[model samples]
Target: MKKRPVKAAMIGLGWWGRKMVAVAKGAADDLEVVSAVEPYGDTAAAFCKENDIRFFSDYSAALADLEVEAVILATPHDLHEEQIDLAVKAGKHIFCEKPLALTREGAVRAVKACESHGLVLGMGHERRFEPPVAQMLAAAADGSLGRILQIEANFSHDKFLSLDPSNWRLNASHAPAAGMTATGIHLTDLAVKLLGPARDVRVVCENLASSFPQGDTLSAHVRFKDGGTAYVSATLVTPFVSRFAVFGTKGWIDIRDKAHVESPDGWVVTKTSTGMPIEVSHVPPAEPVRDNLVAFARAVRGETEYPIKGSEMVENIALLEAIIASAQNGQVVTVA
Candidate 1:
């Protein structure tokens, strides 16, 4: 028997939200975006009309709709906690975007709300679903990368350079530590997964050209509780550069992405060992964004558990808070 697709309402109509809706169209068997909520309704209403989905100018209206089995929040950074609470109260599952909350306390509260409601809370860390990244994660988990010592990652792009100066993404209050919330958070998530919980973080932020008050370039150094370390960097002025590498006692692995996640070309996975010959493998472009949504849908349908744990969700935001604090104080900050 074919199961019905999970009915969903996309709560934001920004660049990424529209992109997600476009991708979800290809996964009709697993999910369906039945409605959208955009306070600035003119442009978004047109988009919703073009996609043949209902539109609402108010979030409460969408929450009141009985057809919405789940709510996909691609809203602003600061609005996530309150929005998640509303969704849980409405008895809807949630698939929230990355940096779930700006503060550790907010992340904890959001996670707890969903857990108490017996609702599935899906996160938006799609990089984990990328084939090459999955391989790298497996290598780190298995004995291939013996005693993971350090992990380094760089996820930078100039995609936001063209945004208006008044855009929330460019605003310091919404997106602190330059590209940390936009891109560096993903790197930190991967690092945490590979190296366990982070103990502390130190960050350096600088504004070379961009209008962002915090900076255009951000570099973060993190030490994990288990003795591993990570160096992560995110730049708003650079061309798309997505790379992740893990170093350990036995070997090292590197994954080089050819293009951005939205429109991927491919990836190159390189492995090097002390004595063994270096090996390189090519991975074709995949729809990890779509994969993440489908996985969330399956979890909503009681098929399987979501890949992101509640604990990790809280930890990532905690690390993000630490990064921002370190950037402000010019000193190491503990990840609480």
Candidate 2:
């Protein structure tokens, strides 16, 4: 059976949103970007002309169009919940990027709105679609990890030290908990996806040497609902590192990627059995952002269901908020 492509209206023409569109072009066969909402009138007009997708200054104009059946949001972190509510109300299926909302209550409200309209709500947690990550998650879930004991992960980079103060990445409210929002938040979602919902979080965010208030380092310790523990760290001024590992009584699996974004190849995974190290192997590279978009298109077309449910989304946001609260209050915060 052939799958029909989804007709989507993309909201936002920023770098990330534009990259999403660029990756989908000639790559995702099941996605058709029919419209775009960009506040910058002239730039949006030029982009729409080149891409051949309709451009509108107001998102509501795109929503009003009958040709747009879905909405793809890459807007600011704060507008997610409100925009999702409006999109669902307009009867459009939605695909929003990670850190879905700035807070848990907002996430819950957005999820409820989607449920009320019976719209498919998709998220762009691109790492979930990475082959190595999928393999590690499968191993953890399929008993290969044997009562998973601990998970350790880190995503560190030095981009923040050179960032301008006005950049959204350096905004205080947008990313108050240092690299928690920019980098470490994905690890939190991955932990919850593989382990379970977070019960409590202990975080310490510090600005080691930078003068910026956004901070430079974030270290979080999370306890899962199942009593499993995880340590996740993210830093702004550091060598590029992407390391994730999960250990259990039986054995452990480790993943190492040389770069933060797309690398020349996929991640290298090392495993152990009987307390002896196994040879590391390369996992086939995948375009995760493209895969994530294709997955959303598939779900909207009814070819498959979206993997991240509304409930899971709420939990992820709650965990993020708890981490921020812990770091600010200087105490462990329980995730509600």
Candidate 3:
């Protein structure tokens, strides 16, 4: 017997939400975009009409549609928690964009809501699905990286620099710690995945070029309870700079991105060992965003567990909160 694709509603029609719809269009065998919810009714209605999907201006109206098995949230950061609560009450599986919640408590509540309901809680961390990153995580998990000592990463770009001054992304309240919410949070999620939960953090945020209230450049130092350390940074006013490196006693692995996750150019990876020749390889461009969506759909179908664990989701938010606190206070803050 053939299984049907998961019928889902995308609850935001922003750029990224539209991208998800396009990706899901390509993966029709596994996931189906049945509808969408957006406050911008006319634009969203036209988009949905062109795509042959239903559109609703009210979120609760979409949730009441029994055919929507899941909801994908690509909305603003501040609305994630409240929206997740609504989806939970409606008995829908959830796939939320990154920095799931601005605060640890909110993240904990979101995770618990889904867990208690036995609903799949998918997160938008497509980086882990990237070929080179998956390879790096495999090496770390299998002890090929030996005793991990440190990881250094920087994910930066100038994409948001030209946004209208009033855009939520440029506002301090929605996107704290400069590019942390925009880009650095992904770095922290990967860091915590490899190094375990963060123990403490120190940070510096500065507005060097752009007029963004939360600043344009961010640098963070994190110490993991298990002894690994990480230097993470992001800049909102730079050419695309995506790089991740892990150093261990036995060997080291470095990955550099030729394009951002949204564009999917490709990746160059270099592996070095104590007495072996350096190995370098190029990973072809991949649709990691689609890959993540399919993975979430599979989890919703009970075919497999989602890769990003619930604990990691909460821990990433905790690390994010600590980073923001440290940046604001100019002092180290413990990750709660």
Candidate 4:
């Protein structure tokens, strides 16, 4: 093939952002974090020094770099729309983390901006690159799973308990519907990937244990545009649990594992059809986040199309907003 290493900017040097930078460091052949932006200068400077990348307190400074052709945004939820718009205007390919935008309009606007600029926009739905998620997608595509019927997932972890008031994730406006935006959105993305866009959403969520303003638990029911339905839940203050089950007319495939990129010994999958559920261990043949980074590089190089297109991104964001609205209003919200 071709060697097309993208000079990229890593924005938002928080927990997840730092992890992404590490992935970039690991995949040094495919992509490079040539620049980084984080409001807290000390930590960002230290990190950039460690990684040997440029550091900036403001994102616009990174955009000025002619060599940085792409950017991976791990910024706060509310900041995505404006930052994406700016990046697209800067003529840079973009990869943004999950819950692309908190509002439907904002998400649509971001997608459209990328389209108008003719830029590759990749959503960091990293789990989509995961082995389990990839297997589920294969089932949906290859007829291994018959006509899709439903998807059930419960992805939760105990990380939010560590969040202090100063963190953006603690604010309801930043992470509405409790774990919905922070964690459950992965299942939602899997729903879209396996069953297509969601048509309706009903959610119930709460912060059960914390004295802080955090959303701890959430359960959402989604109706897909293509007749399949899904139930996905997430909790904040609990042992890590990541299970995604996709049911078809013939059989159901289930993957059980800990949260992303964590080495929990390994992952397991169970497929049930005739009688006993067949279990198998899965050690990802390739590192998922690294693969995603390489894929983004390919997209930037015009070697292939971006798998998650702008339209699907817009639809997923619509569903995300619907889920949040449903939880807050205590009713089913039809996805627009």
Candidate 5:
């Protein structure tokens, strides 16, 4: 018997939207994008015509289609809440980009809407699907790393000041906080995923570059529920660097760059107190976009569980709120 492919629609055909379209096309056997909604008529019309798919200037038209089982949102950070709510009401599964929503309340409402409607909501924390990260987490769970003691995560780039100020990312009205919320939030979310919900968070923001109206850099200190602490540093004013290291009571793991670790095959595992090295072969996963898209397709088909949960997004947003509050108040804020 022949099986039907999952019909999908994509809202927003901007930079990220194009990349998502490519991924969905690559997974065409399992999923197909039948409709795309973009406000830019020329771009949306051209893309839809080239791909032989339906195109609309408004998302409501796409959402009204009965064949569209899922909708991928690649719009700006501020629009996620309303779009998710509309999709949920229309009974469509949702795949949303990172951070989920601008505020904690918005994220909570999105989660609640999806839950009430019995729809699967997937967030774009794609790094969790990376093979090296997956292995490190598994080893930690198996007691290879013993009790985790500390974590250090860093993600920084020089693009903030270099990019045009007209970009929505530079506008705090659209994104709220600065570099940490835009970039470091991923590291913060990843840390929480590896560890647990952060118990407390303290943050500081500084205007290291004059390009932004507000601060262009942010640093945060976090304490997790298990007594483990983490430091996240991010900036748009500095050179590029991305890394994450975890120290446990028995040993540690380090992930450098995006794919490479520090030990053999770019992964390093060591005994905590003794400083003795442990042997492990680590291979990076395929590109995260492909991995996450495929995972979402499988989840839609009930073949696997969604890698990122809606409740976890609620926590991530809550922690982000606390970080911003701590930065603004110059005091540590406890996660509620």
Candidate 6:
């Protein structure tokens, strides 16, 4: 007997919202987007009409539907806490976009609410589903790279230079923290997933370009609980580059991009002890969105664990709070 697909409602019709729709369509066997809520009436209507999905301007209308078992939030960062609370209260599972909340307290509250309700809460740290990143995490856990000593992850994009100042991403009130929250959160979350928790964090933020009212670049130095150290650099001052380097006592792994770790030419892995280089050849996994949505749907169906947990999201938010505090105080802040 075939089980029915989990029905999902996506909130928000921005860039990420459209991408989520595409992913849900590709994985329609396991999940189906029954409806969507978008404040922008015209855009939402057009999208729904084209995709043959129901659309509503009010979130309550969408949430009122008993057929929708899960909600995918693609709204602005500032709205996550309140919306998640509402979804949890409504007994709907949730898949929220990253940097779960702007503040530590908000994140904790959301997690507590979901836990109290016994609902599945998943965060969108989709980079973890990428082939190279997944492989690296597995190897690190298996001690393929002995005692990871240091990690450096960087993400940079110059899109802000051309973006409209009125966009939500450029507004500090909406984004809270600038470069780090907007782009670097992915790397920070990845570091935490691979190296456990970060203990002491020192951050520096600079307003390199005045295109947006907020700072354009942020650099964070973090020490892990396992005595490992990492640096996360995020900036809108350069062309787009997404790279991560993990160093350990025995070897190191370098990932050029999250999506193409397994190119036809293969990835390069080098051993520090033997000084031998090996080309790792494996097919890249499916698109991260597909994997992320599938994982969330499976969790909803009781077929698997959620790819990311609410507790992990809270921890990441705590780290972000520490980073922001350090940037503001101009000193190192200790993580709790």
- lDDT by residue (tens digit), candidate 5, 5-79: 679898989767877787777777777889899986477799888888898899999889999999999888888
| Model 6: lDDT to the true structure | 0.80
What value of lDDT does candidate 5 attain over all alpha carbons?
0.77
Q: Per-residue lDDT tens digits of candidate 3, residues 197-292?
A: 999999988888988889898999999999999999999999999999999988999999998877889999999988999999998999999999
lDDT (tens digit, per residue) of candidate 2 on 197-297:
99998988898978768678889999998889999998888878888898888888888885655442578889886567686888766688888888878
lDDT of each: 0.91, 0.84, 0.92, 0.82, 0.77, 0.80
Candidate 5's clash total is 4
Model 4 misplacement above 4 A: 262-265, 274-277, 284-286
| Lowest-sum lDDT 10-residue window in model 5 | 260-269
How far residue 85's Cα lies from its native spot in candidate 6, in Å, is: 0.7
Over 192-213, each residue of candidate 6 has an lDDT whose tens digit, in order, gives 8777878989988878676555
Q: Can you tell me which runs of candidate 6 are displaced by over 4 Å?
A: 258-275, 278-285
Ranking 5 against 6 by TM-score, winner: 6
The estimated TM-scores of all candidates read: 0.98, 0.94, 0.98, 0.94, 0.89, 0.92
What would the per-residue lDDT of candidate 4 be over residues 148-265, giving only the tens digit for each residue? 9988899888887776777888888887787888888878877887778888988888768875464677899899887989999988888888888888877788887744554433
Higher-scoring candidate on lDDT, 4 or 6: 4
Candidate number of the best lDDT: 3
